[model samples]
Target: MCRSSQTRRACGRNDVVSTWDSLRLFSPAQYSSLPGRLMPSRPGELYPNAAHVVDYLADYEKRYDLPVQRGQRVDSVDRDGPVLRVGTDSGPWTARAVISATGTWTRPFLPAVPGRRDYRGRQLHTVQYRRPSEFAGQRVVVVGGGNSGAQIAADLAHARIDLIWVTQRPPRYLADDIDGRALFDAATARRRALDEGRTDAGGVASLGDIVAVPPVRAARDAGLLASRPMFARLNTTGVEWADGTRAEADTVIWCTGFRPALAHFAALRLRGTRGHIATVGTRAVDEPRLHLLGYGDWTGPASATLIGVGRPAREAARDIADFIRH
Candidate 1:
């Protein structure tokens, strides 16, 4: 997601520097590609960095001749009789159907813990985190057990910070050999099994949450990857456990995750009580003319990832075309 107005403008124009900028750049240096996926890295480059991803996306856009409307921030999307009206900073446009592909990166979620406000130390979501050096010499508590949390904790450990990595449960590390390709295959198989009325064998989730990337593996070997149980509550100085043990910290980095960036759809009122828009495939059940993409499995299995999004995207496109043809 764009970190600033300047970056937003550059991203709108599909500028390589700003499209995936900070989020990708700030990822650990050892971050590698999801092997066997589309968008292979340049020759001899097995581990692609943020710059490579940016260049790949830019090249893809140019090759496909994608027409990107620059500098327009979509404010709202509403129904206008037979069509959908999209209100953006630039103006408004009407379409027979609207596909909302805006992802969740912009909406960082921090859980409400007791005494959160009273805690005087700094608090930031993963989106706001740039590098390990920023927290130098401070006691940092990294929360959440997801990939970002694991990765961030690993990053901080290497920096020699006083770090306490806490999770709701012990962090699950995938097998050393497992990677994105394996995860995708497992998910596909699980989906097929469920479709055939068989027992739903867990997919990627069965493998584990955190991928054993090089950095995480290194930290694990060094015994710095051990995680503590989540704290009971926050205090002015730090976090306290249910057993009343406390650890003073200078900052808490929340990798708790994010909600979909769906505020623009408020006018459509598509979301149910759970704050999710029900979907049959990617098409909204309440509003067939509306489609949501790259949110999560509710839309399509693994649809949130680059390799996985293509299947749902193609299905959405086909469905929309068929709807228009009739």
Candidate 2:
């Protein structure tokens, strides 16, 4: 954490800056080694970096002259080569073999709160949060338990703005604590172990370790961030806690993680527990011609990350080739 004693919000409005096109891209190397089973191994920068991978995919298509479609969001699948689809603006589109890489953000898990849809305090998900300067000098509340919430709180702490880091569960690591690297290293080790057959014992131990550390204390000590319980309701002024406590904020950031964006194929019987798509070793759904990139492991660390995506993509491609040959 950058410790400039002068409180960040103390900077006048003129000092605060906002960058709209704050998007970023990741290098192939980082993507190849992303640690979380379903996360894109993004290079940490001030801006979001997945756009780089999208660009790289486009470039790969051009280099190989592969017929890759860009900006075509698939709407539905059918025998006529997969039906209609759309653009980022929800325009129409279609395809035969469909692959969903949208990951968690597109369809976030909005909890069942009575008046949540009515509260208007600039509610936005971390996915929508490109940078912190937008909320400079304003009271902000962040809700989530994972890395996203931790990182955003840290960023805001640097800005000298009042921030409340809330989660249904409590915080674990310190705000200044950079302990995710340890988990990443452990996941990497587990991957190697599975490859070497050390714990091929049905991937029982391959699960990410469940470690919990006290939240508010570390965050408070590292930075002056506050923590609280699950949200019960929200109004124009602030959020109401389950215990009847209320926290005021100008903005509420839902960092409560993501859900797979596969509602287009909800009718298909391809999902496993919790509506997640089940795959037989990364090969496309039931039709092996198409393949799943970043899903939870059917077995192994296959579902946790972009690093997981690479192996599945390769394996699926090979399987397609074999199918073509036979």
Candidate 3:
């Protein structure tokens, strides 16, 4: 969990479940409480919506009577005297230390395509997607292949509009290495094979058989939704594919995924692998006081799954708590 020679060796086993108290869990979801009734049905479903999270936090405060300020957006955090000074949108407060949990979702990753700002269609990120009804009767193109991408693509499949799923890479089995270019090509081939209702020549699995995520795989089974490669460019009127094909859509949901908001944390000398903060397990570069939870350490072996992240979180919290206790 704390990323040393010993911890790395121990992590080689898949069944290890570390104690929870050792980690500092900075769940950005805690910033907003949730209502009790909202639940996510699928693994990647956006459950415990922000409202639910906020409601839960309020209950937690009532139980433990913790002091939590709502509607306060934190501006800066710095060590000052015996406590850390956190400057928020409202005012400043102090803490013996801080756990920065502003999640990656707050920072949606958008591509810097040339004519993006000029597109007239309702271009929105998944973060803003409240419900599917907003997209009823609209042709929708969803981009990306990660959990969010897959879920959104599946959600918008039944709206009676032209639904095109585009991604630079394809989805692979949980254990696959997730190599980008190779995955994209593989996914593209799978889409075409599934559309034509034939087994892929290369033995790749078809998305058409999938039964979950709005059960749009039935469409693929029924030959409705056609998975395709990404568009080459975006114009106000429509999208231009690499093959020079054009399709107009009423809305484009960029479920492309998110990147860590390291810009706000630039002062920290973070070591990075793949443009993301690199970690030795959960520990940040050389800063033991800082740690990362959801970073993809390796694509598969030591992935950053929710289950994987828990171990590091517990370890970090324990280490930080001990230091503070002393």
lDDT against true structure, model 1: 0.76
Q: lDDT (CA) for every model shown?
A: 0.76, 0.53, 0.51
lDDT of 2 at 270: 64
TM-score of each: 0.89, 0.65, 0.62
Candidate rank order under lDDT: 1, 2, 3
Cα error, candidate 3, residue 305 (Å): 6.1
Best by lDDT: 1
Worst 10 residues of 1 by lDDT: 1-10
Best by TM-score: 1
lDDT per residue, candidate 2, 166-243, as tens digits? 776655542233233344445556667766779643332233222222332344566565567777888668888778
Over the stretch 1-326, how does candidate 3's per-residue lDDT look in tens digits? 11211111111123232211111111223211222322223244322233333334345446665454444556655556666566665667776544554445556778876567777898888776655677777788887765555555655654455688887754432322222223334544554565589875552233221213223334444555566887888889768887889998778888776775444344444537545665544555545555555444322112233323344456667867886788
- lDDT for each residue of candidate 1 in 1-326, tens digit (9 for 90 to 100): 11112123222224434221223322222322222334654675444555676555665666666677666667888889988888876668888988887767777888989989999999998877778888888999999998888888888888798899999988898888767667777878887787789998888888898877777788988999899999989999999999999999999999998887788888888888556799988999989998898888778877876667888888999999998888
RMSD values, in order shown? 4.0, 10.1, 13.1
lDDT over C-alpha atoms for residue 254 of model 3: 85
Off by over 4 Å in 1: 1-38, 42-45
